[model samples]
Target: MIIISTLVFFALLLIGLDVGFSMILAALIGMVLRSGAGIDPVMAPMTLVSSVDSVALITIPMFVLAGEIMNRGGVTRRLIDWSAAMVGHFRGSLSQVSIMTNFIMSGITGSAVADATATGSILIPEMKKEGYKPGYASAVVAAGSMLGPILPPSIPMILYAVMANLSVLRLFLAGVVPAILLCAGYMVICGIIARRRDYRAREKASWGTRIKVTRASIWALMMPLLIIGGIRSGLITDTEAAGMICVYALVIGLFVYRDLKYKDLGAVFYHAGRTSAVILFLLAAAGPFAWLLSESHIATAISQAILSISTDHFTVLVVVNLLLLAVGMILEPLPALVMFVPTLLPIQAQLGIDPIHFATVVIVNLMIGMLHPPVGLLVFVTSAIGRTPIWSVAVEVLPFLGWSIVVLILISAFPGLVVWLPNLVMK
Candidate 1:
C-alpha cells in the first residue's frame, strides 16, 4: 500500500496536477485499496476537514495578508533605503545592503519568494549599476531570502508547529539563533566576494542621514518586533498578533507612508486570498495523506528502517538532512513539509531529539533548497528579477550555499542553538 501510494503521488506530480490534489488523490487510492482491512473510506474526507479546522491556522491567512499589503505599500523601498544607509559604506556595500534588507524584509514577509522578489526587484538593478555582476546580485538576493522561513513570524514554522504538535511560540523562538547565524555567515561571504572582486563602497553616510533613514524606516521595522514581542509576553495569541499586524500594516501603508491607496487594497486582498487558499488547501489535503500513513504504520516502518541502519543519533540526523536536502531541491517547502514531517516526527522519539530542534534542522535544509538548482523557486525568481541567466545565478549561489550548509551542520550538531532561546523564554 505504501509503495503504491508513493508511486501514485509522484506520478500525479509528473502529470501536472496541483500538489495538494495529488496528495489527496494518492491517499484516497490508498484508502480505497485497503477498505476491507479496517480502513474506512469516511476517514479520508473527515481527516481533510479536521486538518484545516484549527483556530491557529487562521494565523496563516492574516500573516499572508499583512505581507501582501506591505509589499504593495512601499514598505520594501523604505527597508532598502534603511539597509543601504546602515551598510552602504562597507566594501561590497550593495551586496551587504541586499543581505541586510532581505533580513529585515524577511521579518515582514516571512515568505522567501516574496523576499526574493521584493529585494531582487529593487537591489539587483542598483547592484548592477554600481559595478556588481548581475549573477552575483541575483545570487545574493536568492541566498539571503532563505532567512524568510528561519525568522519569527515564519509561515513554514507555523505549519511545522501544527504538524508536530509543538508550540508555535516555541518554534518561533527556536529559529532566532539559527537565523542570526545564517545572517552573519552571509555577511561574511558578501564581504569576501566584494574584497576579491574589488567592489567599491558608497561614500559613508553621516549620522544625520543614518538617523533620518532610521526614522523613516522604523515604522516598517516595528512590525516584526511587535508581533514577536506580543506573542512572547503572552499579551496575545499568534492569531491575534497576526490580525494586529494586518491592521498595523494597513495603517502604516495608508497613513504613514501614504503609498497604499484605498482602491489598490482590492488587488492586495485578491492576491492574499489566492496565496492563502493554496496553503490552506495543501494543509487540508495533507491531513488524510498523513492520516493514511499513520493508519498503515508506514511512518513507523520508515523510522525503524532508519534506526536499523544506525542507532547513532548523529548518523541518523545526517542521513535525514541529506534526504530532506534532496527532496527540497525538487519540492517547494510547504508541500514537502506536509508530506515528510509526519514520516520523520516518529524518529524524534526514537533518537531522543527535541522536536523544535529537529524542526529547525528540517526548515533550514528546505530553506537552503530554495537556492538550489533545476527547480529552486527563489533561484528562478531572482534570475528573472536581476535579468541574469538562471545558470549564472546557480553558479554564483554555490558559495552562499556552502555557508548555509555550514550553518545547518552547526545547528544540527548543537541543538542548543535552536532549543536554548525557546527553553529560556518559554519557561
Candidate 2:
C-alpha cells in the first residue's frame, strides 16, 4: 500500500501537480484502498491541520523570511566583497569566492536555493567575465549551495529534528564538523580545477584593504554568532532564534545597510510567505502520507528485506545510506524528510546508530540530491542564473558529486565525527 501510494505521488508530481497536493491525494488513495487500517480517508483533512500544529514548525517561515530579508538587504554584496578580499588571491579566485560566500550565507539563510540564487547571481557573471566557462561557474555555485543545510541554524535540520523528535540543538551542533569538512573539500576541488585550467589569480589584498573589507562585513558576520550563541546558550529556543534573526536582518537591511527600502518589505514578505506556505503544506500533507506508510508496516518490511541480506551493522548502514540516497534523488529534501524519516527510524535504532549521527547523514545525503536530477533545484537555480545549458552544468557538477559521496562515506563510517560536537556542547 505504501509503495502504491508512493508511485501515485510520483506520477502526480511528474504530471506537474504540486508536491503537497500530490502527497495528500496519494495518501487519500491509500486510505481508501486500506479503509480497514483504522484511519479513515475522511480524516485526511484533519491530518493536514494537525501535522503542522507543532510549535517548532514556526521557525520555518521565520528563518525563510530572514533569508529573504538578507538577500534584499545588501548582505549578499558585503559577503561577496569579504569573500573576494579573503580568498581572491587564490587560483580561480572568483569561483573560490562563490564557494566562500555560499559558506557564510549558509549560516545566514540556512537554505540551499536561496544561497545559490544569492551567490550565483553575483558570481556566475563575474566568473564568466573572468573567462571561466559559464557551465563550470554555475556548477561551482550549485555544488557550494549544498553547504546551506549542513551548517548551524539550518531550516532543514530544524524540520528533521521536529519530525524525528530529536534535539534541534544537538542537530545544529552536529552540523559543525560536516560543514567545515565540506567547505574545505570544495575549496580544494576548486583549486585543483583552477590550477589545471590555468585560471588566473587575483592580487592578494593589502592588509589595510583586507581589514577594511572585514570591518564592512562585521555586522553581517555577527548574524551567525547571534543565532548560534542564542540557541546554544539556551538564551532562546530555535524558533525564538529564528524570530530574532529575522528581526536582526531587518534592522541591518533597513537602518544599517539602508539598501533594503520600506517599499521592499511587501515583496519580501510575499516571497517568504509563498515559499513557506509551499513547504508547510507539504509538511502537512506528508503527515497523512507518512502515517499511512507507518500503518502499512513499511518500516518492518524494509527492515526484514535488509536483514534478509545481512544484519551486520556495517552492511545495514551501507544499505540504508543507499536507500536514502536513492530516495533523495527523486524527492526534494523537505518532502523527503517528512515522508521518509518515520519509516526509517525503527531501522536506524535497530542498527544502533545515534540519532544525531543518523540525522547528519540524512541531511547531507538529501542536500546532495539538490545537486542531482530530475529535481535538483540547486542545479536548476544556478543553471538558470548563469544562462548555461542545464546538462552542461550538471555534467560539470559530477566531480563535486563524486567528492560529496566521499564525504558522505566518511561521516557514515565514523559517527563520532558528526556527534562529537553536539555531545560536547549540548552535554
Candidate 3:
C-alpha cells in the first residue's frame, strides 16, 4: 500500500500536478486501499486537519502578506539602492547587491520566493546595465534570494519548528550565523567570478552621495531590527511579529514613502492572496500525506535506515543532509519539512544534535533545493523577471548553488556555527 501510494504521489508530481493535491490524493488513495483491505483508516481525516491546525501555520500567510506589502511598498527598491551604494562600485557590484540584499531582506521577510520577486525585479536590470550576462544576473538573484528563508523569521523554520515540536525562537536564533555564512560565500564567489570576467566596477560615487543613500534607506534598514527585537524581547510571538511587519510595511508604503496608494492596495492584496493560496493549499493537502506516512511508520523506517547506514554522528549528519537535499530538489519547502521533521527529530536527538541547529541546516539545504533544475522556484522567478530562458538561468545558478551546498555541508559538519547565536542570545 505504501509503495503504491508513494509511486502515485511521485507520478502525479512529475506530471506537474499541484504538490498539495498530489500529496492529499495519494494519501486518500492509500487510505481507501488500506481500509478495503480490512485495516482501519480512521486516523486519516484527523491527521489531515490536525496538520493545518497549527497556530504556527497562521504565521505563513501573515509573513506572505507582509512580504508582498514590503515588495510593493518600495522596500525592495530601497534595499537595492542601499546595497548598491555600499557595494556597487566593486567589480560585479550588482551581483554583490543581490547577495547583500538577500542577507538583509531575509530578516524582514522569510519567504524565498518573496525575496526573489522583491530583489530580482530591481537588481536584474541593473546587473544587465552594468554588463553582467543575463544568465549570471538571473543566477545571482535566484541564488541570493534563498538567504531570506534561512535567516531569522524564516517561514521554513516555523514549519520545521511546528512539525518537530521544537522551539521556534531558538531555531530563529540558530539560523543567524549560517545565513551570514551563506551570504559571505556568495559574495566571495561573485567577487572571484567578477574579477575573472574582468567585470568593471561602477564609477565611485561621492561619500556624500553614499551617505545620502544610506540615510534614505534608514527606514528600510530598521525593519530587520524591529523583527529581531520583537522576537527576542518577547514583545510579540512570531505570528504577531509577522502582523507587525505588515503594519510597518503599510505605514512605510502607503504613508511614509507615499508610493503605494489606495488603488495599489487592491493589487497587493490580490497578489498576496494568490501566493498565500498556493502555500495554504499545499499545507492543506500535505496534511493527509503526512498522516499517511505516519500510519505507514515511515518515520520509523527513516530512523532505522539512518541508524543502519551509520550511527556515528558525523556520518549520520552527512547522510541526512544528502537525503534532504535530494528530497528538496523535488518537493517544495513546506511539504519537505512536514514530511521529514517528525521522521528525523528522533535521529537528531539520538545523535546529540541540537534541534535548533538541525532545523537550521535542514532549512538551508532545502533552500538550496530552490536552485535545483526542474523545480527551483527562485530560478523560475528570476528567469521570468530577467526574460532569460530557464536553462540559461539554471546554468548560471550553478556557481551560487555550489557555494550554498558547501555552506550547507559546513553547517551540517559544524553544528556549533548554527547554534552559537542561539546559545548566546537565548541563554
Candidate 4:
C-alpha cells in the first residue's frame, strides 16, 4: 500500500508537479496510508532532515559559488581558448574543442548545467559561424557539458556519498579515469561525425601563438590541480578547497586578469545562491523520501528482485545499467542520486561491487539524463543559449548520446576504469 501510494505521487510529479512539494506530499500520503495499517508518521521527515544535514553538503554552495566565480572571471573563456588551440588542428576541430573545453571547465566548475551554460553560450555561435548547423552546435555543447559533474570534485558525488554512506574522497578519486575515458570517447565520436560530415578545421595558429595561448591559460589550468592536490594530500577538505577556488577565481579575475569587476560580484552571488537553494531543498525533501524508501522495504525488494532475475554479477550489472539509464531519462541528477543510491547501493554491495564504481555508474547514467529529450535540462539550457529549436539540438545530440552509451557500457563492464584512480590515490 505504501509502495502503491508512493508510485501514484511520483506519477503526479512527472505530470508537472513541483518536485519538492510533490515529494513531501507523496511521503505524507504514504505515511498516512501506512499509519492506518499501524505504522508511524514521524519517522520519514525526521529521517529526511537527518539524511540532508551532513557537513559534506556544505560543498554544494561553495562549489556553486566557485563555478560562478570562474564563469564570470574569464577563467572559463581562457580554458576554451587554450582547448581550441590544442585541438583545432584536427578535422572538425572546432567541435572537438567543445568537448575539450568542457573537460577543462569541468575540473573547475563540477556542474554540468554550468558547463553547458558557460561553454554553450560562447561555442554555439562560434560553431554556427564556422559552418556547423544550429542543432549540431547545441547538441555538441549539451553532450560535452556532461563532463562537469562526472569528473573529480563532482557535486553529485558529494550528494551520493552522503546518501549511500560511502566515501566521498574515494568517489571523487573513482571518477578520474572514467572522466578521462569519457572525454576521449566523445572526442572520437565527434571526430567520426565530423569526418563523415566533411567538417573543416579552424585556421591553425602558429606554434608560438599556441604556446602563448597555453601560457595565458596556465592560471586557469592550475585551479584544478590545486583542488585535486589539496584533496589528495589532505591539505584541505573538499568544502574548504571549494572556497579556495573562489579566492583563486577572485584574484585571477580582479587583479591578475583584470576582467572581473567589483560590481559583478553581486550578480554572481545571487545566481549561485539561487542554484544552491534549489539543490538544498531537493536534498531536504529527498531526505524523507529516502528514509521512507528504506523503511518501506523498497531497497530490499529491489535487491531481491535483481537476484531473482540473475545471480550472476555481470547480468545484474547489465540490468542495473539499463534500469538507471531509463530512470535518468526522467529524473534530475541530484534527486535521482538521493533517491536511487539508497536503494541501489545495498543491491550492488550484495553483489560485491565496489561502492565507488557503482557511484560512477550512477553519475554517468544521470549525466546522460541531462541530455535526453523532454526533461533534459542540459539540452534545454544549450538550446536556449544557442537560440535554436530544442528538437534540432536533440537530433544533433544523437551521435553524442550513442557515444555516451558506449562509454557507459565500458565503465559498467570494467568497474576498474572508475575505481582505479580512487583506489590508487585514496589507499
Per model, state how many residue pairs clash: 0, 0, 0, 2
Clashing pairs in 1: none
Using lDDT as the measure, the top candidate is 1
lDDT of 1 at 54: 84
lDDT of 2 at 162: 86
Winner on TM-score (2 vs 4): 2
Candidate 4: 10-residue stretch with minimal lDDT: 1-10
lDDT to native, each model: 0.90, 0.88, 0.82, 0.83
* Ten contiguous residues with the weakest lDDT in model 3: 36-45
User: Which consecutive 10 residues in model 2 have the weakest lDDT in total?
Assistant: 311-320
For candidate 1, the lDDT comes to 0.90
Which stretches in model 2 have alpha-carbon errors above 4 Å?
36-38
lDDT measured at residue 400 in model 4 versus the true structure, 0 to 100? 79
lDDT tens digits, residue span 135-231, model 3: 8999998888888887767877877877788777888888888878888888888999999988877777788888998887788788877877888
Per-residue lDDT tens digits for candidate 2, residues 1-427, read 7678988998999999988899989999999988875767877887888889999999989999999999999999999999999999998899899889999999888889889988998899999998998899999999998999999779889888988898887898888898888888889999999999999999999989989998989888998889878988888988899899999999999999899999999999999999899888888988788778777888788777887888676677788789878987788988888887887788778877788998898889888888888788888899999999999998999888888888889898898889888888777
TM-score of candidate 2 versus the correct structure, residues matched by position: 0.97
- Compute the lDDT of residue 170 as modeled in candidate 2: 88
Per-residue lDDT over 1-427 for candidate 4, one digit per residue giving the tens place of the 0 to 100 score? 6677678767978788888777777787777877866657787668667766788888888888888987888887888889878898778888899999999888888899999988988888988987888888888888888889987668888888877777777887777787788788888888887888888987887899889998999988888788878877988987788888888888988898887899999999999999999988888887666767777898899889988999786688888888887887777877777778888887888888777787788788888888887688888999899999999988888877887888888888887788778777777
By how many angstroms RMSD does model 2 differ from the true structure? 1.3
Off by over 4 Å in 1: none
Candidates arranged by TM-score, highest first? 2, 1, 4, 3
Task: For each candidate in turn, give its C-alpha RMSD to the true structure in angstroms.
Answer: 1.3, 1.3, 1.7, 1.6
